[model samples]
Target: METKREKFYMMNSMLCLLKVVEGKRTTVEMRDEKEVTGVIKHVDGYMNISMEDVVFKSLTGKKKFDKFFVNGKTIRYVHIPDEINMKSAMEAKLKEMCTYTASMRVRQEIKDQAWAKLKQKERRAKAEIKKERK
Candidate 1:
């Protein structure tokens, strides 16, 4: 069975990989078939990110944003920049993340996850009450 610790490690690996791309011009292919190129300004452990000087392109045309935020779930593939040495960068980032404090977005993601669990509990309680009544 996959333990929670293992899952957490996997998630951290992804976060570290992305951290190495910080301040670099990178391209991200989103799930909706749109593509964005920007200088990644900030990235959290949850992969929630803010980018600056963004250029978004899709089949229709293109758009620009002074800044943009992307939810990690919507990202399909991240194109690592050509000049980056992946193995070294990943090793360095992993070390950094081990001692890193949670960013604002990561803190929010934690809150949101907790809220979702509470909602699920509420739903189950309601179902149990209904079952007793019936």
Candidate 2:
């Protein structure tokens, strides 16, 4: 069997940074000059955000909301709490969120088992061909 060497890729990206601030208080400045301060509840791959206890502020006025959603495209800037160190936060969040989930692990195990069984059958077939040749 030939072993494939894979290149190492770090999970370093803006969404990775956003994942660190999940369930934490943060501020998002919108492109339209609105600002939202709240606890970030969720951040998806597209950078779309769901927040709780949101306070939306604009030049016109301020509004409070129990929950809010921010489109990824409309976001201009994000303010993560100063207490959260970027390096440490990214490391911790990546460790927690980047690993395969239990379901994924199970699926991978099934795939490997199937591949092994297939290989074993192929080897047995080759062995039988050799016996016939003898």
Candidate 3:
């Protein structure tokens, strides 16, 4: 029987792996011990992964093996390391979001200022006409 702490660790590890796959380009080590270093292109029904550049679809509809097949289990599911360096990618995304938010705020501010100015001009024009009529 697995302990609760063990189950929690497994869940956390799974979530971390999913984040790694979805977040940025990563290298995964297969069960065969093959260190496949490439961006994860896609994951299939059987959890089989197609890595970019490193793994190729041959003309015969077979996967071509690279130099290192560590444990000879063919191609096992890819495993990303517990920790991935995603600082730059995260920073770039955050910066993009901040820039978009800032641009929207600036646009709204400009619109508000323009509308206020227009209203003030209209009020001044109306007052001038009234004074002339008096």
Candidate 4:
């Protein structure tokens, strides 16, 4: 029941929203001449954003409202640099690889330690039982 133009617009909006989520920082301007700036932590489907000090929830049927806290109808604009995006992507990949390698090493070490401890305990128990029997 949707037209091609509507689908295109929806896709474009989704892309824009993703870019905003991946953005390093966002600029939130309220109607009360107050501006909030910080890294966007999370965003919901309703256009709500969690910033440093404040949480923004989109208002319905309101272009702009008064009072920074109650003003739900504010503009949330985010600008991300291409270089930052590339850098973040590379950093993420590197961190993932490092985490995987470290996890594998830790798991191996834990298994080895557990096996060694079990063997030592078994030996000690066997020696104690033999001594008791004698």
Off-target runs (Cα >4 Å) in candidate 3 are: 1-85
Clashing pairs in 4: none
Give the clashing pairs for model 3.
none
Native-to-model Cα distance after best TM-score fit, residue 57 in candidate 4, in Å: 7.3
Residue range 1-134, candidate 4, lDDT tens digits: 33455334433444234334433555666665555555566544334555544334434323332222222355444444444564565455445545765897899999999999999999999999999999
Q: Model 1: residues >4 Å from true position, as ranges?
A: 1-11, 99-134
Per residue, candidate 2 scores C-alpha lDDT tens digits across 1-134 of 11111101125365778877888998999999999999999877767899999999999999999999999999999998998899887877677654644556789999999999999999999999999999
With candidate 1 superimposed using the best TM-score fit, by how many Å does residue 14's alpha carbon deviate from the native? 2.1
Q: Write the per-residue lDDT of candidate 1 for residues 68-133, one digit (tens) a residue.
A: 999888999999998999889888766554444346458889999999999999999999999999
> Residue 74: error of model 1 in Å?
0.4
Ranking of models by lDDT: 2, 1, 4, 3
Tens-place lDDT digits, model 3, residues 1-134? 33455334433343224333643355555554445655565443223455554543333443544322222235555554456555544455445545765897899999999999999999999999999999
Task: Provide the RMSD of all predictions against the true structure, rounded to 1 decimal.
Answer: 12.0, 7.0, 12.7, 11.8
Error of 3 at 59 (Å): 28
Give the range where candidate 4 is weakest over 10 consecutive residues by summed lDDT.
61-70
Models 1 onward score TM values of 0.64, 0.70, 0.40, 0.36
> What TM-score would you give candidate 1 relative to the actual structure?
0.64
Worst lDDT run of 10 residues, candidate 1, spans: 1-10
